[model samples]
Target: MWLDPFLSELQAGDGLPVLDLGCGAGNNALYLTERGVPVVACDLSEEALKLVSERVPEVRTLVLNLLEPLPFGDGTAPAIVADLSLHYFHWADTERIVAELRRVLKPGGLLLCRVNSIRDTEYGAGQGTELEPGLYESGGRIKRFFERDQTEALFANWTIEALEENVLLRYEKPKRAWMVAARRDWA
Candidate 1:
């Protein structure tokens, strides 16, 4: 997860925890805690939560299904990390989750996320059912790939700090993805 360049601007605080949404494998949780930021890592998979707990006992872990309502109170976090986690929703659910992220963050809070790109041929990107533009239902799972304009429209309400296309070797396979660093500038 890309953290330093974007999150370096924020002032970390005890009242403002960093939420690791869909914190699969706990790598990002480890990253946050190592940086001395308190983190509440959440995921839908019990096994994933278990891994996080085992690896970083200090991180508070929650089993969260992102499609449902989030559990945090308003303005609870100063930073939210959704590494490779926000791309697997239908269009409407995507909007709600984005709004929820905004609602829970303090004004000027940062959100860093990565989603599968339409150019991700390495991960079976273009082989899914067309739910909507750049959204697909592949292998019984809903996956949404993002275009640059689509990403801008999705987070138009926020100050888009950084939005770019990049590729990374995930699980030994090169996966194309979009990285977005945005901030809720106001309530």
Candidate 2:
């Protein structure tokens, strides 16, 4: 889906390391691996990593909890991508995770993030979807929706390259979500 465009922006011979945070099922990992990109796919679920390994053995996967500090050295990766998984963290934890992500990424490296929009219809502002109270279920996991400006403010230091809000349909119903991209400044 959106992965192709994101991948298209990356140069083939960039030779920079890539980390896929919350790489569930590893579909993107498998696709990127086939393109000769070196990717470190990580998730909190061992079972999910195992499944990804069985399906795409070439992808390097490690068990990781995003709430804690990242396992890589500073400026280790040139590109970091977390698709539809960051919302699981509370606002405080989210700040730490973003800081960790910036710490790991090289200067001018890209961070691609996709999160649910607050204007969602089906699972937008409902009681059943919230993990605690304010959050909602964006997909198979619990998430908190955000306005465009809120998302931009989360990474205020970085330069936002693009931001888009779209409705991902489920069984012919529109589900509000957003895809945003930002670049870490040279430090």
Candidate 3:
């Protein structure tokens, strides 16, 4: 989907490793593999991992709990992509996830993060039970929407390379899109 073009920027012949955080059903992971990037597909849902394995037999899949710190060493990967995943954390946990992302990313690595922004259309709102004070529930998951500046502040250390907000017109309804790419300082 929408991440396909963004992922194109990270492909490097057998040299780049990508961590597809919260890789739901492995669609994006599979897509990256087709482009020749090694992808480590990770998510909290066992069922989702099972489906991904069945669909993309070649993909490397891992079960991950976003609430817990990531299981990766420092500078282990060159690029990390998390699509529609960060919103799952409550406002308080945002920093932890950001730090975990930074931890696994190599110096000068690139990170692409897609989350629900506060300006999303009502149609993008969730229907699940709320676990946090302001977050909503959807797909048996908890998520929160962020304003542009709020999201930027979460990854303050990185230099933002690109930022785009898209409003998807799907079936006469709008879907919010918040896409950003930032680089970790090489030092």
Q: Which prediction has more favorable lDDT, 1 or 2?
A: 1
- The TM-scores, one per candidate, come to 0.94, 0.86, 0.85
For 24-94, candidate 1 gives per-residue lDDT tens digits of 99998898788777889999999999999999999999999999889998887888899999998888999
Question: How many clashes in candidate 1?
Answer: 0
Over the stretch 105-137, how does candidate 2's per-residue lDDT look in tens digits? Answer: 888888887887878646555534566434665
By summed lDDT, which 10 consecutive residues of candidate 2 come out lowest?
125-134
Off by over 4 Å in 1: none
Q: Find the 10 residues in a row with the least total lDDT in model 3.
A: 121-130
> What's the TM for model 3?
0.85
TM-score result, candidate 2: 0.86
Task: Output the better candidate (1/3) by TM-score.
Answer: 1
What's the alpha carbon RMSD for model 2? Answer: 3.1
